[model samples]
Target: MVDSLSELMIILNRTYKEGNVFKKVVKQIPEVEAAKIGEISKRISKAKQTVFEATAHLDRQVWQETKTSAQQGRIAAEATRKTAHDIRARVIDLQQETSEGHDKLSSQVDQFRSQMVDAADQMGDQLAQTKRQITKDGEERKQFEAGLQRLVDALPASIHEQLQSALYQFVADAIVQRQLFALPSNIISPNSPPLPLVQYAQVLSESDIINLLQTPDPIGDADRILRKESLMSDEALGYATLLRQKRQFKEWLSSDWPSLVLVDGCSRGESVGRTSPMSFFTASFASTLIRAETGIVLQFFCGHHIDPQKENSGPKGLLRSIISQLILYPKSYNLSLNFVDQGLYDAVAASNTEALCYFFEKLFWQIQPDTIIYVLIDSVSDFESDLHDYGERMDRVLILFQTLIGQVLQGFAAGPKLKLFMTSPNRSHRLIYRVDQAKESIRLNAAALGDISRSGERSLREIRRARSPLSYIM
Candidate 1:
């Protein structure tokens, strides 16, 4: 018990020593060192008592924590083992279910395979039956066709020919009517060949239908059918356009007569003109002028069938038309009346527009004072465009034409001046300005001029605002 108290004393002393403030206060008591040492002894006793109680409480807490921790660990281990056992049971069940499903699938596969075999056999029988039916139908068709052919062969040649002719005529009529309605009159060509379908009708309509009956050459018939089918397709709308142009021509003649008139809108690029290009328009214009017989319509429709080249300025057809007229009516041009029958004009000399220019001027001067000479030169731009060097050829031609007209006007102190009319694509070109700058440029009737002026100014303003100065040069 004494040794125990001694150990308790040491424990108490160590606990007090660790409390540095209390130890320092106790040690600094210099005046009452003995009394302070006694108080330290009392403190040591109290501290020992307190340490004994704290030790007992700590020991109890450690024992409780250890027991609780051991119980928790044992419970966690039990739960883990139970969960693993459940998972193993589930795995076994899944394996058994998978085996059963696999067996069922195998059975199903066997049943499906048997069904597929049965279906295949049935399909094979059906296909064979179908093929046999098709063969029977083909044989019947061939027999029927042969019998019909024989009957046709027995018919009289004259009867067959009449029937063939009637059939072809019917077909031709139907095609022509159908093509006429297919497009608007303004878009179609009035002059193109009747539907190439006509040729097929011709095969029947021709004198050779009897030959077809006599020969029965299947290969030749097949070739003809193929050729008919391959014939070039209808490229232009017809009937309506012809009618419309004719009507328009009548209206123009009634309105503008006796005065030298210029038919100027002739560019493909100029949207302001008729949607139909100059080529199409000129045909109608020339046709009307010819029919009118108002005066000579000297037409120079350059680049009509040929590519625009320098040599294509005046087509030979133009020269022919002019020469023919001069020969037929030499008196019309103030030449001696005898010259008409003799065809005295030098055909070689009047071959081109340049050579024929003098003749044209004389003809212009001599026309009946009341009759206006309409000079229709359509799509001059097409020829001008191809001239390159920026319309140099056209520039020279314009100058020559101007000089010729000036001389003609001076020579013909009387009446019937050549109505010098031409067209350009737009206002940017020199030709448009050159003609525009002329003293007696054809004036648009008053109201029309005002509308054109306002529209032109508006267009110019928009163009100027939209485009740069450099683009103007181009």
Candidate 2:
């Protein structure tokens, strides 16, 4: 019973101790709550500061972007103003230039009008003078005819009969000559002859002969066509002058018989001016022949390295150009074109080489007996092109001349006399050989030219002035 009492007292003591522990925990609750509230206030203050800093950073970015945009807008506005000013200035300049051009054009037009008016007045005066001269000529002709009739009537009966017969014969001859001179209008055909002589005449008046031949004009120094400026060099002129003084050359010029003179520049050494100088010599000689007015001068300056239609540098173009020049020759002669028959016209229209040769032969036969025809063909070597069959073609050209010369020799008693003058360079041995075969051909080598290169050189301007048409008349 005493042991149980001791255990109950020990329990009571332990319960008292646990009660003390509870009281102590209860007392620390207020301090713990105070500490937690202080920590929460600090956290709230930090959060407020962070939000303020973020808002301030956003405001600064917005202000900077606005300032940049304002600056760009100001720059763009200035650029636009500058562009507008430049455009206005450009427009003003263009307007001023246009006004000046218009004024200059108007002034030119006024000057042209005045020149045209003066030309018209001069033409009118010339026409009036021509009409008066024609009237005077007609009156004189009438008076002469009346006087002749009175003289015939006053003659004796037997003498009058003879005079009347002679007068009738003269009138008939005049009528026949007139008929010969008339244009070949009667020979025109619808299907065959594409262009009649009359129409061809019109074309000749409007266009150059080179265009009709469908051949490029012979290339020269400054012009395509052979002009005085480009025709001859000083050395060539001296050679030509020297040649003209030669007894043989003068004989050829004055010869009544048909002849072929082949000038071979090839016979001499390389230094003998056998290239362009040879061409110049031939051209100068031809010009001299033309100025002499001895006969109809037909010239063909063969071109080298011609492309596309290389045949034009050969005999085909030569014949065609000759026929063309013949048709236009004696520009003052009032002849009805009786010579150009339908066949010849057709051949010319067709441009058939063989036919042209045939018709040319016939035309040559038809020329007035005793009339001299000079054919000057320069640079015979230039007939050869890059054509595969160039040799054959060149042979054909040589054969054509041979045939013509043969015909002339055969018909020595009849037909018009033809004088063929040809020039060749030094390299063309074959051509020189072929030409040398002609019995009637008179060959003049570079030795005949006689140091013409050593002669004084004349300026091209001087040559042109010297070769002027007025110089020829003088």
Candidate 3:
């Protein structure tokens, strides 16, 4: 029994030892669970640490981006400010340049004004000087014209042509530069007349003469004229002769009779060949007399041609025919009141001086005019030589009126006044000689006759160039 109990106790002891080993295993299992839990915690801690590092990297990148953006914005603002400053500087420079140009223009305007003022003052001075000079010249010219008028009026009728030509030349020299002038190329005269003393042409009026020289139109004449119409027209001497014959002495009253007379040519006929006429008939002479102040005076010119048949054939016909008509005219005067022989002669001879002088004296004694009678003869060369032949004939012919003057002087207590003018042709022609004892008595000596010359050729050339007065003056 004891042996069996000992075995059981030993087995139980072994089993208890195994149970302690199991307990130890169980305690080791709890420690393993704790270790597992610690490992998981370590892994979780690593993940969290990775997340924190990623978050820190993202924060740094964001900070860098924001700083760079701010720097770029500041740089852009600086550029805008610089551009604005440069634009302002250019605007200021342009304004200064414009102001400088305006100042220069203003200076030029002031200079132009100064020059204009000086020019105006100079023009005023010239105007004043010219006015004074014109006044002085006018006075001198007036006095000269008056002297010319008086001198020309005093010239005797006999030398009017030479004198007139000389006068024209003097005027031309003073006024003009040329002498191209139109002259009368044709002059026609007929032989028929009412009396031997041919009166001024009755039908051919002054205007008719002018028209004849102007445009002379012949009725139904298909032929051309001798002279150009314009040459003989109003531009030349168409009516100049009319102007020269203003005074008619025959119509003058006793108080209005002419004291001075002028004549042109003596007689134009064949009668001049035998006896040159030194004296003229009283009635015929009176017809062509003019006084400077009063009375009718005429200028009668007989052309050089005596007759067509004679050497110096005048216009035409004979002087004997012309003189016969005058002698045939009946004498009509009272013998009781008039002098029957004082200045009257019944004889009619062609070449007798005594007959001519008595006839001349008879004509003068009939007229009793108030003014002094003055006779003007153009030339003594035209008188016939055979007319003055004998001594008794020459005495009566030369001083036939001296005895009548003595009788009239005693009866009326004074004598009728008479003056004579005998002009000559050439400087050599003897026109006057001592007719009586009276040396102071008066006679036109041929040597005393003034010789007039034609004007210079150069002077004529200049006058002809003068522009026509009708063209511009009128």
Candidate 4:
């Protein structure tokens, strides 16, 4: 039993040692598990660190963007404020300029209105002045016309008075008296009541003479000649001679009774020669009268041909030509009338019988007071061969002569001693008998002219030898 107990003790000791070793191994395993867990925890920590860094970077970028956007918005607001201020200033300037312009326009309108009023006032004054001027001119013209009328009326009257005065002076100064021929007893007696002196003319009415002249017929040789019709007609043959005298005197009065006078015979048939008996006698008488008076003017106008049948041989043409000559005479004579103004000379020279009377009246009024005039008409019947035409022409002349004679006589208290002398180729002239109350009709032959020229100076035979036709005797 002892031995068996010993062996069991040994085995128990060995098992106890093995159990201690297993306990040690279990403790070491637990330590190793704890170390592994520590390593895994370190790895997880590093991953979390990386994720945090990335999130921080994204947040920083977002903050920077927000700041830049806010700054740009503020700058835009400032620029808008500046633009608004500039626009306000411009509006204020425009209003001020408009106000100034309106005021200037108003001032100009006022000035223009003042100027218009002044112009209207001036126009009214000018109109009044023009009206006054027109009124003044009208009054002056009326006065001028009145003066002209007075002058015209006085002209003839003054001339008649002057001629009467001249005649009176001449009568007082003249010593020798030349008398007209004594009247024949058969024709007119000293006591015969002046048979109506106008009865000598077949047609005494002035109207009849006018009618004859106005009738439109050619003035032919037959009209101018003393045809059988005229001789056989109721009118006396001497009527033509009276008619001729009338026309000659009327023309002479119109011519202002020229200082130079011409007396002529316008005979038809070859009577004596060309010289007129009346002309020769007048020339001799004038020569004698001129010796007595220094202021007497005398001239002779003669016809071209004694025969009326010859061409251009009328007394009318010769008389007109003589007046033209006087008109053209240079005003060299001391006593010549001043006719240079208003073409007076030419106008008077060209005037017809009526106009000539007016001109003569005016001209004669201006002549010297002492001038004496003597007019002698010869062979009045010789004016035209046709007695009827000659009588017609003479009617107007006779009326004019009557007027002039009456005016001259009226101008003087004692009656102007004016004398008229006439000669006719025909002895049958009734006018001579009718007109000459104080004188007689003397038959003046060619020989009678010589007797007057050399009366008591030459023998009758010598005078006969010297005598030619009446025309040559002058």
Instruction: Give me the candidate number with maximum lDDT.
Output: 2
Write down the worst ten-residue block by lDDT for model 3: 218-227
TM-score computed on alpha carbons, candidate 2? 0.46
Better of 2 and 4 by lDDT: 2
- State residue 29's C-alpha deviation in candidate 4, in Å: 99
lDDT of 1 by residue, 231-344 (tens): 211111111122222333334345433322223332334222222233343444455555656565555544342343433223333333443343343242223221111111
lDDT of 2 by residue, 142-201 (tens): 999999989878888899888779999999988656444332333222222232443333
Instruction: Find the 10 residues in a row with the least total lDDT in model 2.
Output: 186-195
- Candidate 1 error regions (>4 Å): 1-31, 158-474
> Candidate 2: lDDT of 104?
100
Between the candidate structures 3 and 4, which one is better when assessed by lDDT?
4
Error of model 2, residue 185, in angstroms? 24
Candidate 4 regions with alpha-carbon error over 4 angstroms: 1-271, 287-295, 299-351, 384-389, 412-419, 428-430, 437-440, 443-474
User: Across residues 25-114, which tens digit of lDDT does each residue of candidate 4 receive?
Assistant: 333334544554454456556666867887788778777877887788788888889889999998899899989989989999999999
Specify the poorest-scoring 10-residue window by lDDT in model 1: 232-241
Q: Model 3, stretches more than 4 Å misplaced?
A: 1-346, 349-352, 369-371, 384-396, 401-416, 427-431, 435-474
What is candidate 3's lDDT per residue for 34-113, written digit by digit as tens? 56445656766777798899999999999999999999989988887888888788878878887887787778777777
TM per model? 0.32, 0.46, 0.25, 0.32
